[model samples]
Target: MPISSPRPPPLLMNLSLRSADRVSYCADMASKLAMDKRLDDFVMILESNGSDLSVLVGLLDARMVSAGICGLICEGRVGEVVRVFRLVEGLGIGAFELCDELVKAVLGLELRRLVEEGELGEVEVEVEVRRVRERLKRQVVRSVEHGGVEPTAGFIRR
Candidate 1:
């Protein structure tokens, strides 16, 4: 019989599992850290006594989304990511507050990959960059139309 190569795992399956694991792990860690810092303070103030794992999990999920969004915003560029983060800090978006650190980490990894591949200026990547920029523009317009402006870099009159 002729020898044959084994099939590799599907890309979708690999991505789905990896993303799920990362989100779950990050959320759990963030919740635990938050509780450690706030437990005594909450008790002193007579607030809720115990932490809710469900809520923490939800926050983590939110963090994952925020990180993804920020990654898209910067087109996976490291310098751009840092600039956007500083802009985000200035804008004071509540969403940014929760995921700023996570977003920076994700963007940093993506940027490193781009550098390693030596394909930062490739046409395909440029398409992706343009798509992200369009989405951001739409989001900004929608926010303005809805009378709710998300705090972002360049949102304020300088």
Candidate 2:
């Protein structure tokens, strides 16, 4: 007699299917928001992830992957962004878009910093952006044990 594999419990199967449905719904909506370039709304939908990174991964679409990257970058989550990039960059166009958005975001952030801090120079901003570009180009990264990007210590979240 051939051995048969045990089936999953009905309750477990139903729960798993429901969870997948939820992730799909969130992913579709998040992709739409990303296409619309609604970064804040994209991030808002992210809070619905309930701290589950997998749900967040489903929310990423290559063409608009930058939307997710930008939103999280604004949230100061460099490590998380890198982790996601590692998973999805091979799907695209995504790596290029991610780099472009990273530059734009860094410039925006630097400009905002200049406003409050009142003494930053363009050269400094340029250097920082260049550093980030070089790092990404190298695919070299280091994440903090506490779930943040290393070296900069500016990985803040609001």
The C-alpha lDDT values of all candidates are: 0.49, 0.56
lDDT, model 1, position 135: 82
Which segments of candidate 1 are over 4 A away from where they belong? 1-64, 67-98, 123-158
Q: Residue-wise lDDT of candidate 1 within 60-102, one digit each (tens)?
A: 5444445445545455444443443443343333434545476
Error of 2 at 31 (Å): 1.4
Clashing residue pairs in all predictions, respectively, total 0, 0
TM-score of each: 0.25, 0.34
Q: Alpha carbon lDDT of residue 48, candidate 1?
A: 25
Candidate 1, lDDT over the whole model: 0.49
Question: In order, what is each prediction's RMSD in angstroms?
Answer: 17.1, 12.9
Colliding residue pairs in candidate 2: none
Cα displacement (Å) at residue 58, model 2: 3.8
